[model samples]
Structure formats: C-alpha cells, structure tokens
Target: MREKNHVRNVNNRNEMEAVGDYYLNNKTLGKGEMKMEAAMKMRIADIGDEIVSNKGIKGKVEMVKENSVIIEILENLSDREYVNNRTVVSHKNYVII
Candidate 1:
C-alpha cells in the first residue's frame, strides 16, 4: 500500500510538472493564438462582448486612424498593430485582442 501511494504521488507530481512546462513554453514562445484565445475566454466586460480592433487592448472597432490605441501585451512582444475590421492572415504574428 505504501508503494502504491508513492507511485500515485509521483504520477501526480509528474502531471503537475507537465502542465507547468506547457505553460512555461507557451509563455516563452509567444503564441499569439494562445494569447488571443485566453483573452477571448476572459469575462472582463460581459458575455457577448463586441470584439473590435482599433487602438486599445480591447476596442469596439478595428481601425481608427486618428488616435491609434496601443495595448501592452505580456506575451508575444512583436511590433504589430491590430487594425480594426480587417481579417488577419494565418501564421502571422499579430494580436487580435
């Protein structure tokens, strides 16, 4: 019984470590899609929040030439702007938050 408990503990620790490693790698590699997914999953304002790309971390529209909004992203430190109302090309590094 003691041996079985030890094995279970090890397995639990391994699973925890795997989850930690996955988050660490993704955080370092700067996956834009992952960041966008996380942002979209957040319940900041409310459900059915209008997703717009303009000049803010979260905007109501994508493109506003006047007074461009800038949001500082923790992950994916790429120099890119989210233009409102534009379809993003796949495999490109742009934050659609």
Candidate 2:
C-alpha cells in the first residue's frame, strides 16, 4: 500500500511539472515575449474610449478594475448572455481605439 501511494505521488508531481513546462514554453499557448503596438497606458480618463478585441468584440469601457477592464459589450459578437452583458477584459488582450 505504501509503494502504491508513493508511485501515485510521483506521478502527480510529474504531471504538475509537465503542465508548468507547457505553460512556460508553449508559443501557441501565449508564452514568452508579446508584441505591443502602442506604448501608451490606459487611464481612467480614457474610460469612454472605444475598445476592440482580437476576436472582433467591440465594447465601451464601463469600469476599470485592477489589471482588467469591465466592458459593456455593445455588439452581438458573443453568444453568452450576462446581466447587461458585461465582460472583464484584460488590458493586454484589448486595444483602445
């Protein structure tokens, strides 16, 4: 029984390490350096500016949170429905137009 438990623990640790390596080195998974088109930072004053996602979702900034912005999705690009249709978009995942 002890040997079985030890083997299970080893397998779990190996699986966790493999997952970590995948996240840190997989280019397809958005690892490593990223491209930034603009160097300007998003401020509270730019809350009303139009923003777009890579997936073509257009929305206006409703609120700004720590490291993310709350957008009231104005278009019908997404199928999911929420109360007033809001989504928390990451600052890196969107562009202010």
Candidate 3:
C-alpha cells in the first residue's frame, strides 16, 4: 500500500511539474486570476497600551506611524540591547499585552 501511494504521489508531482513548465514557457496568467491570499489585518496598538516585543521585552505604545509604532520599553527581561526612541516597530514585531 505504501509503495502504491508513493507511486501515485510521484505521478501527481510529475503532472504538476509539467503544468509548471508549460506555464513558465507561456507567460499568460489571466488578469485578476492571481489575487493575493488573505492576510492578517494589522491592528495598530493604541497609546498607553502595553506591548511585548518579539524579544520578550515589555513596552508601551507611544505613537502610531503609517505602518509602524513607537514603543517605549517599560520592562526588560534580559540585559539585551533595546531599540531607542526612533526605532520604528511594525505590527508583526510586537503584541499587545
């Protein structure tokens, strides 16, 4: 059964590779057909809200930018070098605590 499944998987992979090659040779991706996948909506951290950095340090949201935020470190877990005032942090860089 395992051998049969493996054979089927190989056949499917070969078929996919052939389709990929054909598409590579013929550059015709239809308009609006290749739309971006759903992305996580970024919720900007509000002022005074506590946040934790990816490095495990706690901070507060000082200001919101166009695509980032200004975080002021309020708590530190380790002696790691922290980002200064001007360091812009994006939504993915921190989590609201």
Write candidate 1's Cα lDDT for 1-97 as tens digits: 1121111122221121111112222232123544454455433322222332211122233232222323222222123554443332211212232
- lDDT (CA) per prediction: 0.27, 0.46, 0.45
lDDT at 77 for candidate 3?
A: 47
- After best superposition, candidate 2 residue 66: deviation in angstroms? 2.0
**Global lDDT for candidate 2?**
0.46
Q: Write the per-residue lDDT of candidate 2 for residues 1-97, one digit (tens) a residue.
A: 1121111122221121111112112221221221132224333315786665434356789887778788878763433456766777777766565
- Candidate 3 overall Cα lDDT vs. reference? 0.45
Candidate 2 total steric clashes = 0
Off by over 4 Å in 3: 1-42, 83-87
CA RMSD of each candidate after superposition:
15.0, 14.7, 16.5
User: Arrange candidates by lDDT, highest first: which order?
Assistant: 2, 3, 1
Worst 10 residues of 1 by lDDT: 13-22
Q: Lowest summed lDDT over 10 consecutive residues: which window, candidate 2? A: 14-23
In candidate 1, list every pair of residues with a backbone clash. Answer: 53-61, 53-62, 55-69, 62-84, 63-84
Q: Looking at candidate 2, what is the lDDT of residue 77? A: 42
Screening candidate 3 with a backbone cut-off below 3 angstroms (N, C-alpha, C), the clashing residue pairs are none
TM-score of 2: 0.48
Q: Write the per-residue lDDT of candidate 3 for residues 1-97, one digit (tens) a residue.
A: 1121111122221121111111111332221221110013235689887755444456778898778788786665434665564345677655454
